[model samples]
Target: MRKARLGVFKFTSCDGCQLSLLNLEEELLAVVDLFDVAYFREATDKPLRGTFDLALVEGSVSTERQKEEILNIRDRARYLIAMGACATSGGLQALRNWASLSAYKARVYPSPENVHALSTSTPVSDHVYVDYELWGCPVTRNALSEVLVSFILEKKPALRGYSVCMECKRHGIPCLLVSQGAPCLGPVTRAGCEALCPALGKPCYGCFGPKDDANVESLLSRFRLMGLRSEECRALLDKMNTYAYRKVQGENRS
Candidate 1:
């Protein structure tokens, strides 16, 4: 049988998600035996440039070039998966969506006019039909392996739904939210990291983005009840998936 063609693409991201594939290590060779990794320059210098059975894209559409690039990728890919917070919910850079781009460029860079970036950092879904999203700062190897095996079996990948709190409970970790009045996003942030931050005694920074049906407003209310200021609540929600979370009604965007 012919090998299934696979491609890995990157955009405006830190390349952490791409690293997840390489981290597969011994299992990575197993995947090589199953598929023809067509384009992943991060792994090899001789990446094939053509249509693929599956294409995993990392990073948000943050420029006109990337906007056009993703469309071409969508046209060529049989299945396209947005493989991290950057691609699915705009990543940490999405924070700029709330502030003035000019002001940010002026404050951060030495030459503001030389800075070339889109006004908004948006998810892949905003510009194209994303077949799936891995929803993480850097997608976990466990999920990547599961998705790969699912592709071979011709079954749907079991992603989406489930909260970080569930994973915390599963790991027998105590709830930081209840035990210490921590302003945690575990209840609203998507599960997959196995509640790593909470287990380490820090509140979830929403690195996986918002879970399905996540009640940002309710969480904010809970934060306020815990004596958190408005900015504090916004800051917590304003991490990797700021724009996506801000869309959750009942909270003020400004």
Candidate 2:
């Protein structure tokens, strides 16, 4: 059988998700054995020019050039998987979508016009079709490995759909919100990180994004009961997964 050719692409991001792939350590070698890494600028300087069997795309589309590049990659790759919070849901930079990019540029730079950028940071799916999405600030190595293995086996990757609360229960950790009145997004946030923050007695910061059918309204009401101001609750929901939360709010209002 011919070796599967893989390509890794990036846009506007911290490259943390690409780093996650490199951080696979032992599994990195295993992945290399399963597929030929035809293009990865972070790992090599070789010129990449061809279609690929699988392409792992990281980062959000934040510029016209990036949008063009993403479309080109999508056209060439047979399977395109969006990796990390940026590629999956526009990442932390999506915060600008809720605020004024002009004001931000004016405040931070001497000449705002010199900085060529788009008004909004959007996910990969906003530009082209994505076969799958791996959600995280920087996606977990275990989950990434599973995705790679599944692809090689021609099977669908089994990503968890439960909330962080389920992982907390499995780890036998006490609920930080109940015990210490801590603000937590665990009840609504996805269950991929194995309840890392809650296991250490802190609240889940929603790094893994919102779970399916998340009850944001109830969570907000609960937060308010625990003495969180409306503004504070809104701010918490406006973190990495702000777009998802906004969509939920829009749906509820409709």
Candidate 3:
């Protein structure tokens, strides 16, 4: 049987998600054996460019060139997977969506006109049809493995959409929100990090983005009850996964 041609592409991100793939170490060899790995700039100098069986795309579309590239990629790949917070929910850079891009550029660069960028950083799904999304600041190795195996089996990947609170329950970790009055976003944030922050006795920062049925307003109310200021609540929800959270707010209002 012919090996499935795989492609890994990057756009505007910290490259942490791709590092997670490299960190697979021993398992990475098996993945290479199973797929053709036609294009991965991080792994090779000479990359084969063409149609791909599967494309793992990281980072947000933050420029006109990236917008065109993503569209072209969609046209070629049989299956496209948007990986990490950047690809799925615009990552940390999505915070720029709310601010003045021109002002920021003018202040940061000597020749602001030379620095060309989109007004807003957006997820890959905003511009094209994505077969799957792997959410995280850097997606976990377990989730990555599960997605790869599911594709090989020609089955739907079991990417969980539940809140991080559920993961806390499974691990028998006490709720920090209730016990310590910590402003935790676990009730709204998507699971898959296995409640990593909460387990470590810290509040969840919603790095995986909002879950399918996240109630942002409700969570805000809980935060207020915990004596958190309106600004503090906004700051918590409006970082890392800000684009996704803002979208949730818009949907609820509509």
Candidate 4:
């Protein structure tokens, strides 16, 4: 059988997600046996050509050029997978979506006029159709494995949809919010990190982004009741997955 053609592309990101794939290390041999490994400069200096069976794209679209590239990739690939928080939810840079572009440029750049950038960082889905999204700051290798195996088997990958709270319970970790009064996004954030932070006795940073069933209103109210100011509540939701949470409007905007 002809092996599936695989490609990995990067944009403006820390490249941690790609690193996870490379970190597969001992297990990578298994994946390699199945795929053609068509294009991936991060793992190898391989040249890219022709259509791909699957393209795992990282980073959000922040430039007109990348927007065009993503569309073209979507057109060519049999399937397009947006990897990590960056590609799925515009990443941390999406915080600028609501801010003053001129002021932001003036402050961040010495020659603001020379800056070739957009006012917002948006997810890949904003520009093209996505077959799947592997969420994380750097996507977990386990999730990547599941997706890869599913694709190879011609079956849908079983991506979880519940909140991280379920993982906390499964791991028998006490609730930080209920027991310690800590502001934990685990109640509203998606599962995948396995409650890693809360397991280590810290609050969740929402690296996997908010769950679709996330109750942003109740979470913010809980924050306010716990002595967080309006601005503080707003700031809590303004991190990496800012664009993914749609239920946070009208808070601290008076």
Model 1 misplaced stretches (Cα beyond 4 Å): 250-254
The model with the greater TM-score, 2 or 3, is 3
Q: Write the per-residue lDDT of candidate 1 for residues 1-254, one digit (tens) a residue.
A: 99999999999999999999899999989999999988897987764577989999999999889999999999999999999889988988888987899999999999899988998999999999988789888999988988888888999988757799999989999999899999999998899998999888898988888888887787889899999999988888888888778776434343
lDDT top scorer: 3
- Candidate 4 lands at a TM-score of 0.95
The candidate, 1 or 3, that scores higher on TM-score is 3
Model 4 — which ten-residue stretch has the worst lDDT? 245-254
Clash count, one per candidate:
0, 0, 0, 0
Off by over 4 Å in 2: none
Model 2 pairs in collision: none
Report clash pairs, candidate 3: none
Q: Which residue pairs come into collision in candidate 4?
A: none
Off by over 4 Å in 4: 246-254
True lDDT of residue 228, candidate 1: 97
RMSD of each: 1.9, 1.1, 0.9, 2.2
* Per-residue lDDT over 83-195 for candidate 3, one digit per residue giving the tens place of the 0 to 100 score: 99999999888889999999999999999999889999999999999999999999999889999999999999999999999999999999998998899999999999999
Task: Summarize candidate 2's per-residue lDDT along 1-254 as a digit string, tens digits.
Answer: 98899999988888998999999998888878888999999998867798999999999999889988998999899999999888888877888997899999999999899988888989899899999889988899988898888888899999987899999999999999888889999998988999999887779989888888888888889999888999999889877768767767777667
Specify the poorest-scoring 10-residue window by lDDT in model 1: 245-254
| Residue-pair clashes, model 3 | 0
Cα lDDT computed for each candidate against the true fold: 0.88, 0.88, 0.92, 0.88
